[model samples]
Target: MSDLPIVGAALSLAQFIEMRDVMFGHDRDLELQDFHNPQTLDSDYTALVEQSKKALDGYGGRHGIHGPFWDLPLATWDPMIREVIHDRMFKALGVCEALGSTHMVVHSPYLEWDHRNIMHYPNAREGIFERFQTTMAPVVKRAEEVGTTLVLENIGDIDPHFRVELAASLGSSALQISVDTGHAHYAHGACGAPPVDYFIKAASDALQHVHLQDADGYADRHWALGEGTIRWQAVFRAIGQLTSNPRLIIEVYGDQSVERSMAFLQNTGLAQ
Candidate 1:
């Protein structure tokens, strides 16, 4: 197998310690999941950040965290709810600043329903964009000051170009695009969206990060590589063509699954 481009794993601090052999000397996404929890962020955030810093000592590869995303939609029209999102995002950026991380992954606000009914509402698309811009204006500014790029990840988004346009419209260096392979595959398989590779191509130079996983197109499986039916070779081919050099992170379940996923990529000469 050809030596693949450097790849990374998305795991917690404990998982990284346990799978150090498989994950060491590679890019990583520390799944600081507690940051997404309002209670944890409100209570034990400093302690958690300190513990993460201590745990990550001696590791040397490009790294980041899965930023706060649960219930934090970017397109809220309600001013009060938008403020809550802004606070949560800033807190997530606080973790980035503390960890010396350069990238933070956030969910795309576009949903499947949005894709289907956007035209019917006429002004809905622009409204979504305007609201998102309002919610993220200050947050993006903070991200710029902290030197962290907010990589917008695909969730239920079916249209690939929507995010590309949104990022381009914002015109901020702090904002870019991210693709979750399984999510794209699901959109293609279940919905009528294009395949995973299409998402990569659409993002093009704006793409900055990726979450690698396998899925059957029916759901967000987050399974180990080769466990599901994603066209990984095609996905990698598209990634190979990108000049952006986005972080390639295996975001699966267990340590064994992470290792197995790595093995599949290695054996196929797609990635290492």
Candidate 2:
């Protein structure tokens, strides 16, 4: 086993509320996500927030939160959309504070379509970079105030360097990188990008959290670790060199897969 602390599992806010007994019965780390509805700065989720805290009562483990990212682009060509993203993220920080979450994962603003256009024009990257910075600065400041770190995760960037630049340029202790194994693997095979280890090595210093899921060379299956083609040994080796280990969470689909995911990792010597 890798001997890394198993940060537990992930669940949508809906799942936690609807399936509390089955989902939160175990004493493991939790990464909660509010992905079901459109949340705004002024919207109230007090009931769900109360239920979330109650579900974890008497449990002892780490906690992290996933901010709303579906159709919410952090870096955008539209200034109005950027404002909306900022509002939603600030609100997400409120949820984090209520739950005592230490880290919140936000989707990176790198899209393959944008990258292609930037490749053709060679100058459009600056605008995208600026938009990302404009979106993240206030969020980072809010995170610092609330004692939560904002972890920017890669989505569709053909190159991982964009994430490095985003985190480095901001230059805040509240901002860090979150490399999703499935997304990086898909980017590698689908975009002819560098291997997954490249991302782990490049983001090692700023890396703080991970979504440990497996996928084929095709889509982001989010399957059990050994059920797909990721090179677990190489991934751990690269991560092993990091000065600080990240919070490892097994993000899989289906309820049965949870046990199977942890079993595969333990069997393959990736987790204990």
Candidate 3:
């Protein structure tokens, strides 16, 4: 065995029972998908939390949740909007605390437009960073208190180092970087961003989570492994160099995709 960590999956609450055996067999790090929607959080998730606890009774593997990202950008400038963002994040964190999840995935606020305009508007980048810092300061503090690491994932990011730099500037252990392979591949093919491997290298030790999905490099396909053009060998090679032991979750679309992805990786000797 290579000794590198085996890959995991992002499973919804409904899928837990059906996939419980595979998840428990590998001791997979799971990214719970139920709490990402703002509506779900706004309504009573008490039942959901209780249900999750019951379903995951003896799961000893790492657990995390995909935090709310729908219209909840971290770099909002308006104070009132920032408050909403803060409230949403805090609510998500509460779920983490309840479920004993050690990680939460938050989307990056950087846009491809910002990268092209940074030189023209020199202060814009710092403004975005400042807005993010202002918005996340308290959330980050609460995350540390709850023992959950908030991983900032690349969405429309063109510059690979921006999130890494933002996490570095925060100077908090609660904040770290996350890479979504499909998104990176889309950025590379469609927007001229560096390939997925560079994203990993730039994150390096700051990397704490990954959404592993193959893509055509033209769109965020979220395809099963070996079904798209992403260079899997190169991606895992970069992962092998990381000392962070980041959670690798196969974040594809279907229920069976995780198994298919894992089989591809295992057969190819990329991970097991």
Candidate 4:
């Protein structure tokens, strides 16, 4: 396995340059996105990609794109959303080519924000599954065209088992899984389920990507290493047994927490 499967975290190109100059010293490797602007994504992205390319050359680390989340989860069931999401992803892929990122991380969308909409889709549960089959098909097409692998992450209520099975069933080898340990942990807590069982049950064959992080005992606090009650020994044992070492994206949401978390990962030596 690629030792630790590319130790990294989420970043935007602007942030990449800052991290490059100050953090990496050589001023290099990282991939990030700008989620705030709806109008300037194109020009903004173009500049970011150029800066990221320069940074990667200096940093001596690999770059990988984590597409934006918090608002535009890709699984949103709107047809118009397809264009907006695609545009964002197109810019991201442009970064991929410039920096030679290993792959792109895409979060699965959440259930409808409106309670009424959820009850109205009739087969929305089924439609939700099919929605990916339709909308995601283009995402896959785009990834191939852009020469990057697209990894779909498991989010709230979107069953992890279902995510892996769907990827396998679709039979698109390029499309793979980004197993979010935190999401799985939270999903289990929300559903009154077991965390270990949830992960162990995932098809090992379908796992190609993964996100590893520890959370505070009762909440998804995104704690630094050894502080969370995630049963790291057990988690590492389970992950180590797998045939392939999936990309381990250590995501610490904002600038404030990234350093401590990165230290924790190194100290824990789970991915090492």
Candidate 5:
């Protein structure tokens, strides 16, 4: 038991625990701001800070932060594109520092992703990799300033290996990897796309967190672990083989659904 790692939920301040005593067991919707838009800045970030402060000071367990993942382009590879994502990182850092979250999960800015096929469409993917490097530089710096770690996640079309290299080259401890299992499943000849292991084997060192969910080997949708046609054991074993236990975040959204999911994780011995 001493070797067991803590399992936790990906939450938003809006669903602070006081609202429901049974969140783990029932269907409850959570309101995590769409990160890509970067516009959902917490107007009352100060107040939100006070609240999460009270939450941890008053309540305890494993608590982590999930940054905006949907709207912002963390992998855009553009120099001036900060106009699209800066505020989101600023606000996300607010919650991380406020709650003392273990880590903040963000996405790798991607381009020409369009549904799925990026690498296969050689013409479309050409040169976008350069832009990816262009965009990450500033965001990497911002993450450093906050004294927080940003777990950059894998998405549909970007090469996870290249993203890992970018984070590594930064040489900042604040930069880390966030492997989204479903995204990998989709990218690996699943997700209605062709065969490609977007996350290369050499990229494992950069990982600091994970998104635990699965899908039929043909789509990128986040499905509940066992419900999906994924080989739960293979995924779990692959992750556990990492040098250390990762901060796992459940990305399959559903209010009450989390309860059953949590139970399933335990039963599958994922907590071990």
Candidate 6:
């Protein structure tokens, strides 16, 4: 209702079409894993792309995709393992190009536990950042070649500063920061990181994407907005003040009510 390019997360093509009007008119955060089976790549995902294009014909809002990142650590020390991630990422990009998606979200590999493992070493933070950048270098280059911004999302990040620093260090226009509100809240309490608002401010300059979900401090509930403990008003205000316009996607559980979440945002004046 705010007409600010809000998106709904549809894990599959069927789910996307189920909210076709809401998506085409507004925007859609398409999740690739829903349609393409990662375990088997023998089948082409082109059909899914065709379906998506058909569903989003004449769409006015920008489109985004959440690339596959599970078990694929971009910053892993092993070169062979990193190659697997790079290959999978490129496959996702192929889908991105087919769907004309402008942005793709990739999970960060900097978990608090891993950071602690290097705490005693010299320049530990810098070293970890370097590994992440190194692993993502090829992905960033591919993104630039295809005219898409690789939005690095915070998942297991210990500090927001390091996350921001990584984006700045890339120095490529193809890279940007993506904040996951639920992850931020969970990390703040579980991993001893700064508050969620602090994470927003830290990454404001480079923030171009967001997975806007609500979660309790205890777990990543993926609850509908206003159903979790997050203070929606403050989060919206912080985002509103950013110089760049970020793509806000409503990512909730399969059974969660997106309509109720949208209504809450409208009724509270957080969104128009």
Candidate 4 — worst ten consecutive residues by lDDT sum?
26-35
lDDT measured at residue 1 in model 3 versus the true structure, 0 to 100: 58
lDDT of 1 by residue, 158-218 (tens): 9999988887777899999999999999999999999999999999989988899999999
Between candidates 5 and 6, name the one with more favorable lDDT. Answer: 6
Question: Which whole-number lDDT from 0 to 100 does residue 146 have in model 6?
Answer: 83
**Cα RMSD, each candidate:** 1.5, 2.8, 1.0, 4.4, 5.0, 2.2
Show pairs that collide, candidate 2: none
TM-score of each: 0.95, 0.89, 0.98, 0.77, 0.75, 0.91
> In lDDT terms, which candidate is top?
3
Model 1, runs deviating above 4 Å: 1-3, 26-34
Any residue pairs clashing in model 4, and if so which?
11-32, 12-32, 20-27, 28-55
Clashes of 1: 0
Q: Write the per-residue lDDT of candidate 5 for residues 93-158, one digit (tens) a residue.
A: 766666565567777655325435654666544445455445556666776776667777777644
Better of 3 and 5 by TM-score: 3
lDDT, candidate 2, equals 0.78
lDDT of each: 0.85, 0.78, 0.91, 0.61, 0.59, 0.76
- If both were scored by lDDT, which would come out higher, candidate 1 or candidate 4? 1
Root-mean-square deviation of Cα positions for candidate 6 versus the true structure, in angstroms: 2.2
Residue 210, candidate 3: alpha-carbon lDDT:
95
Model 2, residue 130: distance off in Å is 1.2
Kindly give the stretch of ten consecutive residues in candidate 3 with the minimal lDDT sum.
Answer: 1-10
Using lDDT as the measure, name the better of candidate 3 and candidate 6. 3
Q: Give the TM-score of candidate 6.
A: 0.91
